[model samples]
Target: MNPTLHSWLERRRDWLGLAVLCAVIFVVMPLAFDVFRLNLIGKYLSYAFVAVGLVLCWGYGGILSLGQGVFFGLGGYCMAMFLKLEASDPVSTKIQSTPGIPDFMDWNQLTALPLFWEPFRHFGFAVVAVVLVPTLLALLIGIAMFKRRVGDVYFSIVTQAIAAILSILIIGQQGWTGGVNGITDLKTLLGWDIRTDSAKLILYFVTAGLLVGCIVLGRFILRSKLGRLLMAMRDKEERVRFSGYDVASFKVFVFCVAAAMSAIGGAMFTLQVGFMSPSFVGIVPSIEMVIYAAVGGRLSLLGAVYGTLLVNFGKTYFSESFPQLWLFLMGGLFIAVVMYFPNGLAGLYDSHGRKWIARLLQGRRAAAKPAPGAAAQG
Candidate 1:
């Protein structure tokens, strides 16, 4: 085949793969599952945001961040602050000593909303903060570390430390951060009750839509010059740097992009689950997000989403059926994936599935073609 034709065919295949994923999320799953299960899937999809970001950061950029939950939590908390504030209107909290403050604040003996919480009352500001706060933090961390030449395991350790510190900070500040329980009972978004089944369904679609958008954006990035540069930097950072490229700048940019994506996931998670807490801001969930990317094939964007759904579904099933054995089972699954299919589900498909598909298509084409005798007669 001509090179141009091959490129077009490859692009067409990618679009087809994406369309199949969309059908599963937007059509098949919703039709098959009840609202409750669909809502759970939405929650699972929320985590896929992190996995997708991991693909760009770790798989392509070669920047492994174990503290992604920090950004995820920040985004969740930003949105939660707005929701919590709306839920704590003066009329709603009239029974509390602090009539216009969060219940946790009132319970903590606060007299008025803290200055920091005051701004979250505005929905517009909260929306911007959801994406901006995490990106800004990532920017700071990236500049500090990348510029200083921090890479490899050292950078990973630093991220893990950040996750631990942020979790502790949230848990320690009960009056403001909702302490160990984090933020709960988020009842409304602009006075539309989010707890309703209808609202949950809407939120699920919204999450799915955003996730699809993110995947597309990831695809675009990977196809661009920047994407090529990222791959180059990942494999040959010093060579690229010596070849007149600013390696640190590329690292920072991709890291910030990853942070923004993870933050969006966190925000959606809060919307779907009706709460945000330190539980998600810690080391464990951050590690789990990495597992999602790892299991999905970090180099494959759509694979990340499938990996997330598969793992979360497995987690739910095993936990409910064999609670005591779920952890061991999960560990075994990870080991199995690493040992058997190191590049993840996408790798498996690339190695075997694509070949099978190609052969099937070839066989069909051959069958549809007229025999030589029939062609001669015609």
Candidate 2:
């Protein structure tokens, strides 16, 4: 029985790690933090989704996309469009020059609704778009890049360029998008007052639950044969192709999946934060998203969550108190993490923390052992 339990621990330690993470996020955090702080954690957890996606796409699959924010923004904008439509119902916008259209559109002097936003009036379509739009965009991008054998630093550059293009387009087309200000003034979701404390608590729970689901999905992928193939492709793409696997297909799959995860986070961000912006869709936030993944231990899904929370919390605290020093501190933190803990926080825990845990368990096992004669009699 002891051996069986030990073997189980050896085989499924990652599951135990995930369970502990989920417990902290769902239980301990809610108990420890006030409503406002809890809500802030939820907002940070939204980026955790993107970081986890990066684990699968960049860490394991060797696809470093610098433009994950594009998917994040796309998903967010989809949700924002729906909420904006609901908020701009004729009665609410009666005083506007053009009632029933978004105020930004009115401010920009647009007389009619944009063709693209028409589909978001329905809640179901908006929800679907949150996932589908990002997935489709990623699929197209992946096909274009991967099919032609473009990858590594070049792929990263292309994605960055794509982010820049989207940000410029959104800002330039003020009548369609919200311009530099992006989308704002989002109020409700399916008649629920999203601004209320109770609603914020509920939304935090929803985000936590969804995040758990994504973690489970990532774990399943990582443990599967496809995951092995991804690692192999990452290390030796030519060898993987020589082995008759469709390397491009695997790359495309991981990229699209990552985009979907980021999109879901973006949608939730819109719900929790009450807005979407090109600022998040631009190169800076996108790279910061990568930093979140790197700091979390790119290979560890749970690490991503903790890393994002820690980094963002620090950013908030320092930017408020020592704004000028924040950037330098952030740079130093990144360098320290990379140089000393290449695998991020999770790697540190795995290397040192797990050794201590193993020693303690072994000591307990030794102490629990019965006398030789007594064991024979039993």
Show how many residue pairs clash in every candidate, following the order shown: 0, 0
Could you tell me the lDDT of residue 93 within candidate 1? 94
Checking candidate 1 for backbone clashes, the offending pairs are none
Report the lDDT tens digits of candidate 2 across residue range 1-378.
257655877787888898898899889999999999989999999999999999999999999999999999999999999999999999999999999999999999999998888999999999999999999999999999999999999999999999999999999999899999999999999889999999999999999999999999998998899999999999999999998999999999999999999999999999999999999999999999999999999998999998999899988887888888998887888899999999999999888877787778888888999889999999
Question: C-alpha displacement of 239 in model 1, angstroms?
Answer: 0.7
lDDT of each: 0.94, 0.93
lDDT of 1 by residue, 302-330 (tens): 99999999899999999999999999998
Best by TM-score: 1
Off by over 4 Å in 2: 1-6, 366-378
Give the range of the ten consecutive residues with the poorest summed lDDT in model 2: 1-10
Clashing pairs in 2: none
Model 1 clashes, total count: 0
